[model samples]
Target: MAILTNARMPVETVNFHLWQPCNMKCRFCFATFRDVRGTVLPEGHLPRRDAERVVTLLADAGFTKITFAGGEPLLCPWIIDLIRLAKGLGLTTALVTNGSLIDSGTIRDLRGILDWVTVSVDSVRSGTLALIGRMTAARAADERHYLDLCDRLKDAGLRLKINTVVTAANHLEDLTGFIVAARPERWKIFEVLPVQGQNSGKVEPLLVTPGQFARFVARSRSVEAYGIRVVPEDNDAMIGSYAMVDPAGRFFDAIGNGYTYSEPILRVGVRQAVSQVTVSRRKFLARGGLY
Candidate 1:
């Protein structure tokens, strides 16, 4: 049976995640790719030319937008070449990073080739961040640093988006003020969700009930008045909704308790490879995946 009941929708957007490692230690991150790390992707990521070929496949597969994601995409030295290739192929290129490696110079470099960026900001409180393990080199970035980073992105004329994962550690904290100040075109709010092979065992302390997630959404609704679109994604809406490529460049989705992956795209091609995984267009739309 098709994973999505409707049975018809082209995968228009994909998160092409790099195989590199992240600098931060976010305990709730479901894309850690820990299972394949050091084994499947011994080199951390694909070679420069190979990575560019993957971009070509995504563009050829009819995807209109591609978000370069990672453990941290900025960590990949040849990311600029891939970005250039994706954009040249008429794909709207974007990035999802921790923002630790970004600065004015970096934003200036990305100003034209990249369309926007989504920085993960789970909590503004240092104490909350510490508990959630969103730290780099054992030091947590303060609220001021993040706000300044937002300003840099904005000043460069690059569109901005903020991604926040609401967990037990930060579900009660009010984020409307921060969201408003950030002035992002969109804000993605995700409830802490566990996934096998990634964060299954590590997320016990970060779990929150659906009710708590809803409460956090309600609290953050004030940002809408500031002309920011807030998109909230619950657990069900998240599963199988996204079209994602892991470090090995294979499609993957979580239709059941764990993820199901396809053969590498380089081997089979997009149509054949996508068939092995599940992606629900209905749930994708419901989760505000289209932007």
Candidate 2:
């Protein structure tokens, strides 16, 4: 469904997740990477014209940052072209990745096209790989490769942020290894939500409660003593200041709230969708949320 166009909403970030298909099968994916065969729906991908128009729309709507995400955004052959288009429009670009498909070639291509790259590094232990069902590479290997990719991107001088999805599986575990080892420009800690799975209706029960969250914040902040910047997204006012769009240009009311709008945003192109949606920022922000 598309968002209803109103004159009171603000459009902060527009995410263009081109595909639902991914290379890895992470158990925590709210998208349910295991049940689905990584299908990129017909409406999921943006053709050249659609992409160009989306950029134009974002520009017209006054959006400064456009994020390109995906099952693995690199899977979209036209991603670099889209980034260039966004940059040409004077918009800052970002990428959300699992850091598996990236290599030297991809890094070279993104040198200037993107302003930031957020990589998901949930855990760094090899033993945990089997737990996450990524035993093929071993958990340690996955973490190592992600760190290696981060190093490569940093060496290339691109800005990088390491995002960790906190869950029941790894909560009490020592994340200092990640703090000391990854040492990224930013370390984002996210509370695990059920949207990644069909049975996600049970997610709340699985989440770290408010008291637990407070403790998580404290421990995470202490990481700064070790030289890493930890940004926790828990009950923070600024969290409400930002908005996210899905792969289809649907502005997310919350992480997995599904497209908050009533129509498929891609129907009109990104620019129009953004313009139509952002004009109603106030109501959009107030549409029953807890940022």
Candidate 3:
């Protein structure tokens, strides 16, 4: 079954980086490339009016889904408004969050606006989370909290998704138990990508070889029986398949060994901005990026 449905359009979905500030500092974050010098980080998200304009522009352009992502999307004060705007325009809306800021009040606030929520949970072991720089302390307690949040989200009648970044640190750790416990509708496993300006030099120690990644995929197959779909994305499979907009509202994509970006959609217009990036429709559909 399709995870979420959307109207047929030229660009089926777009992943917008709502902001760059995050509560946790994961060692393998690709968004670090946005600020290579680590000096000019965005102080806040796109202004509320501007964000609404962007959503209207995307919806007008026939984009069927808009996924609000970030260093931590929940940090954006206008996140719920954006989701509500996108849904109001007849678009399927999703949010990619670290799951740290999720609480009863937040979930209640998001009730009817969001169609999907993807939480980043790299490892079930607290030690692994600390090693990966995802948790500062009380790793075990944090894990329990994340699991409980997933349950609450499910109980609230929201479709749930889990995002696990596979790096050398946690690649070998069996995740079957975590998968079973969470019982998410979709579990996306991504191979750690090395961007030229971000984590390229510092992430070598945390990189996983293709053989190691394949083994992890093989082991993760056990969750299929539980009706949890596993979506795997190695580096090669990710390039050109995603429609990404940085925090500045510029569309960017991986090209060769570096990155390519377009003028901000607000300035050049969505069609012109999207024209600058290459999106593989076949790959997008194969990955179930479309509803």
Candidate 4:
């Protein structure tokens, strides 16, 4: 129930979902809540001018770091431009991607504008990736391409982070090899979260028990010797910590069974939109969202 002491208290970070289109049909995507009965939803991204305005507004409002996320942020045509815009405003910019679309050309374009690039990799094993619906065919090739892309990003001088969703499907798979090879600055492990109208019913089988998650956490420690910092987040730890702006420019939070969104910032302004969502300062700091 603690509120930010001052309206001017700096926002350490903000995550924006630029669009809702994705190439991969991962079994446990929480963003599925935005889709209609197996139909592609309308593009939800703010127009380029509006997106730029929102970025400037947030930057001027004391947000220091901006992370561009999405159903797949790379699918956004203006993603690079947006990154450049954020960088121009002196905001630290980051991107969260599934890594399938990342190639030499993409990394080459992202070189200086992006400060951090976090790729999602659930497992090191090709079979597990296929079983988890991360890829349809050529899982081996996809995995290799992902690792190669990580190397290219590092070579580009961009900080790297890895995100792994520890589900029943791949919780037992040893990921130490990938951790060592990729050598990311951070490896974030998340427990499978079941949003009520999102992937809850369809992905119930993929949920891991608390004890199973603990085992996975213990096993993941093997990568520490390689200097990779592993950060774990269960549902409770993730819910209120994130400062999220949906594709429509509405602030939202996952504090309950489903997402609660604010009125669009374009209509109501950033301060009012932000006040509609709950942000946990303690949890945000604990997760290292601050610079």
Name the candidate that leads on TM-score. 1
| Worst ten in a row by lDDT for model 2 | 254-263
- Per-residue lDDT tens digits for candidate 4, residues 33-113, read 364323322555677898888888888777889999987899888899999999999999999998877877888889889
- lDDT, candidate 1, 204-261, per-residue tens: 8889998999999998988999899999989877887889998888888877667677
Tens-digit lDDT track of model 2 for 1-291:
224345322655566655666666666555432222333345455566766675677666666777777667877887888888889898888888877678789999999888888887777776665565443444335566766787798888778787776666667666766666666777877766555343355445446666676676677786787777777655332233344445544544332343233134556644444443323345335432221
Instruction: Choose 1 or 2, whichever is better by lDDT.
Output: 1
Steric collisions counted per model: 0, 20, 0, 0
lDDT of 1: 0.85
* Reference-based TM-score, model 4: 0.93
Q: Candidates' lDDT values, in order?
A: 0.85, 0.61, 0.81, 0.81
The TM-score measured for candidate 2 stands at 0.76
Q: Candidate 1: minimum summed lDDT over ten consecutive residues — where?
A: 1-10
Tens digits of per-residue lDDT for model 3 on 164-247?
A: 989999998988887899899999999998887766766778999999888998899899999999998888888888888877
Q: What's the lDDT for residue 2 in model 4?
A: 20
Q: How high is each candidate's TM-score?
A: 0.95, 0.76, 0.92, 0.93
**If both were scored by lDDT, which would come out higher, candidate 3 or candidate 4?**
4
Report the error of model 4 at residue 85, Å: 0.1
Q: How many residue pairs of model 4 clash at the backbone?
A: 0
Estimate the overall C-alpha local distance difference test score of candidate 2: 0.61
